[model samples]
Target chain A: MNDASSQDPEQQSMPPLGADHPSVARILRRWRQLSGGRHTRDPDRKTLVACSGGADSVALAIALAQIPSSCVLAHIQHDMRTPEQAEHDRAYVEALAKRLGVDCAFGIAAVSEEPGNLEANAREARYQELARIADEHACPYIATGHHADDQLETLLMHLMRGSGTRGMSGMRPATPLGNKTLLRPLLEIPRNEIETMLRELDIAWCHDQTNDDPAYVRNRIRQDLLPLLRRLDPEIARHASQWSQDLVAMQEVMDERVEATLMEPCTITDSQWRWPRELLQAHPDIMLGYLPGLYCLRVLDNEGADRITRRAIDSWIRSVKSDSNNPTEHRIGPIVAHIRAHEVRFTPAESSELST
Target chain B: MNDASSQDPEQQSMPPLGADHPSVARILRRWRQLSGGRHTRDPDRKTLVACSGGADSVALAIALAQIPSSCVLAHIQHDMRTPEQAEHDRAYVEALAKRLGVDCAFGIAAVSEEPGNLEANAREARYQELARIADEHACPYIATGHHADDQLETLLMHLMRGSGTRGMSGMRPATPLGNKTLLRPLLEIPRNEIETMLRELDIAWCHDQTNDDPAYVRNRIRQDLLPLLRRLDPEIARHASQWSQDLVAMQEVMDERVEATLMEPCTITDSQWRWPRELLQAHPDIMLGYLPGLYCLRVLDNEGADRITRRAIDSWIRSVKSDSNNPTEHRIGPIVAHIRAHEVRFTPAESSELST
Candidate 1:
């Protein structure tokens, strides 16, 4: 018997439903269900797999092929690397796609010589190409094999860069990509799992030499920093992924609060926009969050809304309490909060307004 | 020439005020003026310094002593390391308080044996002791020397531990400690400044050996991690402190939304409660934050609303959307948001209602 049938039927089949190997397939099935079932017109949906032919994406393509789904591979020639190596990578991805009985599409884009916008421009160009392919082929989704490890790396990058909650939340699995959905089914799978799957499938994938170069901050993190973190905790990637999920949930709540605060109706008078002081006082915690914008209004004497400091908010609170008998106005960031006629008023300064 | 004369004349001479130390004296004078120059007999006004005889707290105590107000010092002996060292610390604080002509008090507490609760326990014990001292002296406020560095440390700890916005907010300058207010006047000052002040004042301080010990996670962070971070960016601590202040402001806004979400009236029917599906969907993010407690409500059938999980919340959202037409009551977490005839209704599960 061949290797596929040599093992016990139970072992050779799909393994147990929730087994490690089954997890990838399970996730793919879930993605399909969530996306309202698999596409039928294409039979084997000509998915333009954004494969640099790395272990993660190559493993993804191999596993996907086993699931009786058709896929088409797409490789972007980001001419950032040596011309010889870039061509080699493109050839590898195209050859792999052909071996898997799928058509291949390739695109080349000259990276900008400009310093700051290089990374952003390359990403935009690649995505723009992928979106075009999906539109032309009438494909429902474009799959990218971003694993749990990649998600963790993204999260750590955001944290290191001092990003807000939204940034720290990391990537979503099936966000809208132009007219099509960008499905990242491999996101729940760990990096090691992909490597193991690649080995099991007897697939060879190319590694990008640039990943080892520490000149780029992201490469430094992925190569040096993440290894150190893994040493500290072998499950660091999983933990980071879980943390991102939790933050994503928490961020939703924060976003809602921000919306509610913005949507709350207030009468903008000639002097100030009057809001209930009692209501504000009852939610001191909320006031702390709003203080940054409030500070800009008062300190700059510009009625434009901007971020304020906690100290400014505290000072404003004190002012409101101390000057109860008099009309007291305190600026926090670009917003002003004043007490007049027994009511508190909040307004954005003109200079630091949201428009500016 | 005397040490006082050797110093800059501006630094040596008090501001046009009777208080000591030009800058601190100026602040006090301004505070007094702000208070309408009415000095109330605040016999209960006492400052409890969490002194390890460190430069930071020493400077804080010295500054507080120079104020035209009386204060009592309270020290906590956290017997985590050598008991003898803790005793030495207590003695140093006692002697310093005596030299400054202020009342001194101390409390001894065994460190927590549990791994996870070590820091939490020490903090709880310290505050509990402070409260006891305040009650004994009838003091309405307790002061600690939590400088900017400490705030940064706190923010980093919370961030590393995957805490939400509130956890990342660090310590508040003035928060209620039992019946009394816990104040940190040194929060705005940098650690180096406090050290300089101590040197200038010729005040001797003891350094805690445990601060450098790596057995504790925070100590490891302070000794090894923070230095690396500072090397990467010298202003890391300042930036982190600023970030914490911003988060505090944001948290205030979130607290208000949470309250508003809770206050939205809902009817309870039997074992379940319903809220308007539309309303919940309108503020999905807020609902996500409130999901952990809701999940606990469903699983335990007892709703002592505490923590919620993202998965549990997503599941609830999906179910709500799926069963929108039926309008049947379903348990989410500790609280249930169900669709009703006129509006959405929410109530704690019968079992877990007591916790709320």
Candidate 2:
């Protein structure tokens, strides 16, 4: 066979009646839209479903199975939980794939139990493993189980941490993971809806007991903050999720604009990036505010961008906008800006002087 | 004398020692920066202070009194409280103004005690009264005591309600009110710092017991949510406040761009506002999203814009951008969108179809 997908029979236009749940139809519609018609005509393509045997992922895998595209179930164990729980999850997922008559892949995550970053580390490990599995399966797309409630929680966490529009904009429906594309088909679907779908369809899903553990900040936010918010506004998650999607779209346009208008015109050498003073002054103040972060992200491309503060950006803007003939040097994250009369040059700061 | 402001003697570069609280100095510094050095050379300008007899406003009045520019304390009694409490507040404000050696104006607010809108009505009445007082006193600027905590609280309320960047941008430090300017010099200062300044300066201010009453949503947020956030992040208010300010600045740029790039180029007749189809297509998707809101705010200039939903905007964008362009009519808030091959036109909708 050319590939797993190429060997599969030509699928019918409509879903099979046995697998046609209303939630499945909705998920298929969203997947088609989010993938930009990738599902409509690309019959040879395959998607690796990252199922943790949760309601959300189980539903996603079920929905993708109804559509024409070939799908394989993939389960990853972070080993953060007890061995019994991890093994149980893997077995459940394997059974699910067998029931659906699809191939299955299982992998163990290599997560470092770092203090204060355990959750982040686990996530990184999981995604890394998912990418590796997708590569092995020759699946160009990896679908996940993230839903509207997850979107709302991420937004709340970002808001509490004083993140700007960038953080509050929430996750994208589709983003690249190494060479594979990561897809969240159920991002806009509410968690309760997914659960109801699984119940109505009589599909069993494994629930992680550790999800309620208060030790995790996300769990605390989910249990404490989300319920209180739901009490206040029943549609809080739906509204916040939609708003986050809008912000993501807006930020995409801004990133495009910044890349074309700012990053393109600037001259970059091995040691320094230079931009004409007039070019910097020509843009609107709002666009000017985006420069520092974009510089750190696109130019430096490292962890230094995370430490870049608003105060630093403001001070740098003030210096650039100032009508001073004298040379001035200001440190912004990992880079040091040298401002002169004609142009501004950015160079990597010395290792000893890299703070803020 | 020319005006209350022009009549006042030229002040010194530094504030008098007695009125020189660190918080006051910080407020003045922010005031100068926000005003674009308006306070540096413009010594002949007068500011009307809106004091509610609370610690925050009382401190504001005390700080402004030490400056050279004419300052007047204006207190508006909303009559929301009991007669005894209202009288007590007015009396306390008058006494504080006397202690500060500045002219004081007390006005009884004409507030409509609308069941659910009592707080909003009271606020509206107070601002109206402040504007009237400022106009009579020939004060070009009206200063209020909206500090960082209030900013954080506003952001939280907006986030809970799923507001876009426009709502979560927080309050501006300076905005035009009718013909006068409204200024919040203490916007960046923390609430506790203001209270500390009052205590250190031995300034007595009235206590509003109703602040602790959970009847008000803001009060509830203050009592329950803010404390929880504080326990999590001590600098939450400060960071969120700064982020809000950054959003406000970014929004200002967006507004300016929309006005120039989109609105200015569009054609508006007596009843219809029209834009070339190609012109709409030429702009970035982000700018297209802003077109509907800008049209409502600048073109219609009414409450219809407030009820406009994101879904409506998205559908409208899709309709306008679609290849099949038969004459189409869509209702957007209080406006009707008419899309044709050559141009898209917006006209006020019938009163019968005013609902979003």
Local distance difference test, each candidate: 0.60, 0.75
Clash pairs, candidate 2, are none
* TM-score against truth, every candidate: 0.68, 0.89
Model 2 chain B — which ten-residue stretch has the worst lDDT?
Answer: B1-10
The TM-scores that each candidate's chain B achieves against the reference are: 0.74, 0.88
Which prediction has the highest TM-score against the true structure? 2
Output the lDDT of residue B74, model 1: 75
**Which RMSD does model 2 reach against the true structure?**
4.4
Across A1-356, the per-residue lDDT of candidate 1 in tens digits comes to 12112322433545322224564566556446535565543343446677888887776665444433345677877767888888888889888876654567777666657465677767778789888877766666788888788887786566566554345578877678777788887776678887876676566789854244333667766766566555545665665665555556555666555445532644555535555655555454443344344334334453444255446666777655454667776766666666764667666555325443
lDDT of 2 by residue, A105-191 (tens): 988776655665666667778889888888888888889988999898887677667676688678889988888888998998888
What tier of docking accuracy does candidate 2 attain? acceptable
Tens digit of per-residue lDDT, candidate 2, span B1-356: 12223434442333343454677767766655655574344344578989988888877887777654467899887655788988888889888776656789988775655665666666777788899999999888899988888898887677667676578678888998889889999888878888999888887778853343334557767877777767666677787777777677567666666777788888878757889988887776667777777677766775588778766777888888888869788877777888899798887787425543
lDDT of 1 at B208: 54
